[model samples]
Target: MSEQAPAGWYPDGSGSERYWDGAAWTAHVRAPQPAPPAPPTDEAANVFSKLGTAVKKAASDKKASKDEALRLHEERAVAAGRLVTSGIFGTSTIEIYEHGFVRVAPGGERYAEAEKITKKTPYERLRSIAFGVPEAERAHDTEGPGSPIEGAVMQAMSGIVRGGKLLTKGTAVGIAATGVAHLASNSARKSNLVIATDKTIHTLTNQKHNGFIQVSQKEHNAVAVALVEAGNAVLGIEPVAVAQPSISAPPDAAPPAQISVAAVAVTPSLSDRIRELSELHREGILSDDEFSAAKGKLLAGL
Candidate 1:
């Protein structure tokens, strides 16, 4: 009515087009308002929270697995039974006897359970059960043809116990006796005469006098195989050899000669002596003739 507009459109005061329905202008032609900022959905929030929890759990699991593996490796290392101390100075071996009651020291005390002595100890208390008098009683007996315990004790004391070298007959006998003592203790199931030489290891299996002497080469390659096959039979472990090389000399032999080494003072080098002499001459500390004589002497010595 005021000025009349075009039939299909209405003119807004801003000079932009407006849609006109039959009755009124419509706002469809105006720029649309930005959509309201969307709120986070419950599903999306839950997914993010779960992802964070899963990451934390995976890290915890990895840490636990690593810790468990380390514990198992330590356990296995302990069970393998490596030598703790070299039985060089004096041996502390376990003894098992024939009666099934294990005794640590012969005729001393009987242990109701072997596990009580074997388990949870830093050093293994070896048990052997064979026919022999108590270590204490054996010490008092006189050795020679008539004494059984004396003969055995003397045999055990015959070698280089520290170096593992059994270089003499006495040492060999001593090793055999020790083996028997081990067999006679509470841990031993049977006895054997075990012998180790430089080239071979021999075992007289069974308790029979002069039983089967099984032989094997003393090479590193065969140690495991031999040990496993021999088992707890006195032949299983490496036997200390008889000290066949003999620690004591024969009656006619003389004592070894002692050797002595004397230390000498180091002389100056020829070049150093010449330089010193030259400097002395230049400083008037030495005459030219004296320097020449010293230089000649040093050169000749060199």
Candidate 2:
């Protein structure tokens, strides 16, 4: 259209900013910059007093719209990497992206409104995975009724007492009976697999109390492990044997490169570490005291 007007920072049809170089598009690209800060306004000057109110209102609306758009964009990006599951209660999806992972509730929607949490750096996120399994919690029948014997006894007693009334009390009676059988079968464990990320803990399960639909422990573990591996792969994390730098070199040769264990340890830089700790604090990962302690430690390292 109109010969592209000798392009100089024109829209590139993609969200990212690309250089047109006045002829052909260049390889250089950058994420769109944040909207410019609102210009300072002064109403007391009286010259622009009348328009100040209108300008302020427009600015407020624009800021809100921009914020919502940013939030949605982030949510979608995080959700794109999600791992699907056949959870019963509410389908839960966990996604591990480069910066972090997001576990959204239900099968769809992708948490468009949920905040997009970011990890400080890929190294720290991968480190968490390498360390061990994350914390987990699940819904299990801690105290439903009693043992199978009690359930059977109750079932019999209820049947005898209610007799024809069993039709109306059937559901309640059935639940008790099932609980008893469930406990007796040594199936008191939870079906859900909850795994923690740097920012969030995600739960996935097929435990609907429906006998027909059950996720075996092996399957559950597979999903969790797969998620971890997939995330690690996405972040380019893998185990590698490190060759020790030669301690001795020719007299005139450059000193053998010393492989500092601490330096070799992959972690975010000091600023990134601080930012991560801040995020953890915001997400309730670290209590006030814990955050303070961890922050102090990081600072001390510096």
Strongest candidate by lDDT: 2
* Clashes per candidate, residues 3 or more apart or on different chains: 38, 0
Worst 10 residues of 2 by lDDT: 130-139
The lDDT of each candidate is: 0.35, 0.44
What global local distance difference test value does model 2 have? Answer: 0.44
1-302, model 1: which lDDT tens digit per residue? 13355445545667565676666677756643455879769998899999999999999999999898777555644543443211100011222322121112111112221122334222222322112122222232122232322222223233234443233454244336445333212111222223232223333222221221111111211222232223223323333233224478899876555432111112324454354345334433334444565456556555
TM-score of each: 0.20, 0.32
Question: Highest TM-score: which candidate?
Answer: 2
Query: Candidate 1 at 235: error in angstroms?
Result: 12
Estimate candidate 1's RMSD in Å. 27.9
RMSD, one per candidate, in order: 27.9, 25.3
Candidate 1: lDDT of 173?
45
